[model samples]
Target: MGEKVLSVIPARKGSKGIPRKNVREFGDRPLVGHAIETCRESELIDTVAVTTDSQEIAQIGRRFDADVVIDRPKQLAADEVPLAPVIEHAFAEVDGEFDYVLCHQPTVPLIRPVSVDSGIRAGIQQTADSVVFVVDSTHHYWKQTDDGFEAVSSDRENRQLMEPIYGEIGVFLSHRDLVTRGKRIGGSIEFHTVDHWEGIDIDTYADWQTAESHRSRKQLVYRVTGNDQNGTGHIYRGITLADHLFEHDIVFAVEPNDNIAIDMLEGSNYDYQVFDDNASFVNFIEETSPFVVVNDILDTTADYVTALRAAGSRVVNFEDLGDGTEHADAVINALYEHSNPPENHYYGFKYFCLRGEFRYATQKSEISSVDRIMISFGGIDENNLTARTLQALAELDDQLYVDVVLGLGYADPEQLDPIVEALPDNLQVEINQQVQSMAQRMEQADLLITSNGRTLYEAGSLNLPVLSIAQNAREQKHPYAFVSRGVLSLGQAAYVSEEMIRTAVTDYITDETRRETMRTALADHDIANGIERIKQIVFDETHENR
Candidate 1:
């Protein structure tokens, strides 16, 4: 005992912008087929009809399972005739009596069935004569006066803070009586707001291309963690990847108590969700059913990946060596080196995803002497290597300039303060905490002292020689820095003494030939295009499944 709704889709034969656009292939179906399928799938719509002058469009409508295909008259299909008369002609031709009539345009094929149902429900609930779909316009409006062009509004505000202006989306739901009166919109009208993509009206070739580009957009979820234990490399990488995927819906999923990741993401405009536990996260993923789930946490368990796959999400893991990597559709371990990796695994420095800053940074030039040295120990500096490296540099009798860039999660600031206070006059040390641009800092330095992590790849991009100290056993497993000879590895920090670091730095500075060789090796490697490579992998996987 509900109101009967009839959906009438008008797809005329003649098109001014694109010839025969009504039957043209869109994503996977013809242009008119999208509207027919959307209307047929709508729960509130009782009957779906397509009124078109072209026999080809009528056949496509029938193929898409449209309930009826009304033959529009030649006179009513004229270019100048308004849509109200055509809707009236279709309403009269349809046999069934409907309480509501929905006029859907085939040009706007991106409209979803849920939006259609919502418009109908709003019309019925509000008891309005018609419901018209609209989208909020963000563009600044202008008017041409006698003198010159002037702003439409006197109050000028930021685009984001501006008051909302609505534009019609060419789709409307009207009462049956209004359709008989040759009027689709009249009297008490209810406005239904839809997303910008759903409101795309294809009139020009550019509009068609825009709609096609939006058709491939999908929901992407990044399951990442950032803390003192694992450091914030994963979180930074996730943010960089999310920046490139602006067309899709991106969400960052973190652990319940991971305030470090939350605080970091607050600076970003992306949406994030914090889950209580593994079960809750999995349940949320299942409900969302995202197109892709990217895991940036160091390692993942088999059970966790299985749950994600069961949720119908394409799984991609970064720098993961756990058993779950076996089940992942794609595994990218740019930090670690493998002689032979699985077909799905992309390993080595070639897959390294550098930040945008490094991609455009100027490569370091050869120096006659090492004047400025940079010391950084990744984000967390769990082993307090920054202090150890600084202590090593202080013992040197040579007068040198040193810059210590501290990370956001550096916990041993107290330990670092004492080392800087007692530094000899020969070593002019500057302590920089949470520096904005790592690339700019690296460009100013002749040698870089850092942990064996993503930072090495970043330095390599600039052809800057590095003296590396492995923070842990897992970091020692990464052999690209050592194999490439770009970094003089001092082994693990626990085993490496102050004297050992001093010797390594002293040898690198004195042996100009070795430094030049290292720089050349780094320059020969191609790591700048890793982001584009990873983007291709993600889009290929999502597109194949779609």
Candidate 2:
């Protein structure tokens, strides 16, 4: 028999589903915390080590009292990466030899010390290959064939033999010596069964709820992680969506970048942290993992999605980009192009992107300029053409109030400072990337002006008669379409100059009929329901799989 017992938590850096599963929050603590705490709390386990490709997770492991944290190589972080190789490599590098290796995942948040002890004891007793955990299946399973569900049992006599077990569930115990010879189990394998609630592996929002309820019921202690910024759009939308989904949704973001994007979230009234690198994406997901992981971001080959799915996670995806994408449990795409052809493509928009409650207008048109004209542009003028547009408007003889709507994306604010100060008193500029008073400003303007992007849709939604300009080659030909619809006066975005802006506004201010015509056509119905409708359509399609 080997002298010492070793437990290894394998964590890889790339995760798109349940981003940072090992580090996700359960109750009020980090998921990995629960995993390590359980191990340290275990009496049989002499040494608990964490093997990960992410430095961030290793640090969290160390902080939480893991005996040793091995910084695994990046090559093993791929979706196709296997566990035996990782376990073998970890044991090879360790100081002492081990008879058994408990490859535990942090995402299995409820892995109590008792379960750990049970698995280890069972593994030692089986003296075979390994003793993994399994759950008893309750759902009636139908195997997909040329013919649908006949009877899982061929005959009534064998009905009793159709004993169901949700095989390959959470909790696995491995004998290191046997696995070292290139095998997961000896000739035989056994299972240490766990309750469904205890093995409630988390991966999706639903699983999160179950975990929360479990913690509340059991009074399980947890350290929740909510905020941190690693350029992935994870923390940004994660906290925001949680807020929308639940009223008391306690969310946070840790260690975000030093910029306006992260700064803006600070004011969102959510619990968050901006600390030194806490846990890399790896350790978090493996620790406080979810049951059904829903991935809408990162790449398809991301090991986070692959590993969880491999480990019996119900992996679902909501895609709008199109098909030729990676495999998923179920896909919900509400894009327009997908409907006509249906060639495994998601053509229109994403389901998760929610629009606010629809608010429409009774004022019809509220152009609030006494003598001067209103010049409105979008939040992100990636091209700094605002100054040029303003310069052209300045030459006009008419008293012009060019309301420059500044976006958050434009860089080099030092340059904008003087341009703002030196502007004519008649010309007022406003900057708020959040668009606080966006609707009011849009309605109050004499004629709307903006890019051919989402702002076009927004302006149309508001029935704000527009004077449009194309910001790019793709938009150049189409800004005219808005003009043709009479909702906006099109000045070719690329070729249009200040002369064109002044000329267009001169025409829009003069012709009130055209503005009304545009409003009547564009504001026929509320487009704000697009987001909810999007959600409905996706749910309708995906639920059909069941």
Candidate 3:
């Protein structure tokens, strides 16, 4: 059999930095329990022992299946006393004549069993007297000279070019003889680098909070409603913000719907719930008690926002045009322009939240010709604009390819299928539904026919000239789609005749200078950084009280 190895975990009862730090609850167990449990689970170590002065810590160590619990002497239990004597006492209590000994501190609960096994393997393979875990310093080291502070090394060089300085994280492995000599790391030391997060040794309240930030499963709850009438813009906006907050747990609380909104939620790896009534929604909110509640519905009422605020949630609303806008902590209305906005009201083109694909997208090479025409009304084109636009595109005798991009809510096949089947051979029209790469489709197209909503901004981001038609009066007020913004607003969908669309398309397509001007205006406006700005606002509001 190979030589025996002993693991000694030094956990004293009294702690100065954090009161009752050793026996205090951390996560689900006491601080010392993590160390004891880790040692007990190690395969390389033959025995696991803990040295503690407090009887409570000793009991916890035993309950965690520590092989031996040594009652440390009063002299070794002081706040200022070093851990050398504690490890020596634990080594002496063990009867085994081990070849190597590992000194682990209970304070560094993040130390894993795999690290212990690796350290032991290095000690045995290299035949080294000691092994210790260390982490590379992140900050530039400074030394205090007689005159003032000076750089320890490379004073003028960049931090990346400077030699790395390693800091010990209180985990050491040594030969049995070194333990008796009061030395955890002796001659022939082998250094083992640990993960930066794992090397964190919690000593203060801030340290514990940092550890919790990495370990805690905090969630961000999103509440939005969408369907054919409400449109899926809210659903898209909710998920976009949720994607930015991937560091935390994300949950979507949408109102009951069987539309493409459900498909969108199912596509993503996020938890979601379909609430039937306000009572159930309120109950769910009270139960989860999320870090933040994001409402992307058209307008949130004062009573609803008040109730959410009363539930101890920082409410963030999107496109909030109701009395609730005053009650909300933050509101982003990118499409709809609001005058005399409130303190947290973020409107205009600058606040437009595009998908990740279009944020940093480059404009098309040139507005060469109007050979390819694309039509994308919002996800749920409730106005049946696709069928109408197709009818107008067929009238054009030019051999133009029409790409009809359908959303999840485009379920009116009885009307759409006949339009496609009756289209002339010269006018090549292909229907693509639920397109994943809508940005690429927009980039390739010469003219874009879209509704006044989120897709209008997406088209603007790619510098694709838009022929916008309002789905309803609500969309008609969206100022960004007006002629002033280089978008040819074709009035409301119900009132827009096929001849009107043909006239607008012919006007933009025939005039190359007008198309160029539209593209130039769009290229000047950079809206990619809006998401970051909104994220900062959310972060500030959520963490301000904390």
Identify the leading candidate in terms of TM-score.
Answer: 1
TM-score of candidate 2 on Cα atoms, chains taken together: 0.45
Candidate 2 error regions (>4 Å)? 1-240, 247-258, 269-380, 395-400, 412-436, 473-493, 534-546
Q: What digit string (tens of lDDT, one per residue) describes model 3 on residues 291-398?
A: 678887777789888878788777888887889888888887888676676778777877777788786666765786889999888666887898889988777777
Please write out the lDDT profile of model 2 over residues 433-491, one tens digit for every residue.
34565556655655566665445555666666666676666445343244336445454
Write down the TM-score for model 1. Answer: 0.96
Clashing pairs in 1: none
Ranking by lDDT: 1, 3, 2
Clashing pairs in 3: none
Clashes (candidate 1): 0
Q: In model 3, which runs have C-alpha deviations exceeding 4 angstroms? A: 1-218, 360-362, 541-546
Q: TM-score of each candidate?
A: 0.96, 0.45, 0.64
Candidates' RMSD to native: 2.3, 20.5, 12.6
- Off-target runs (Cα >4 Å) in candidate 1 are 145-148, 541-546
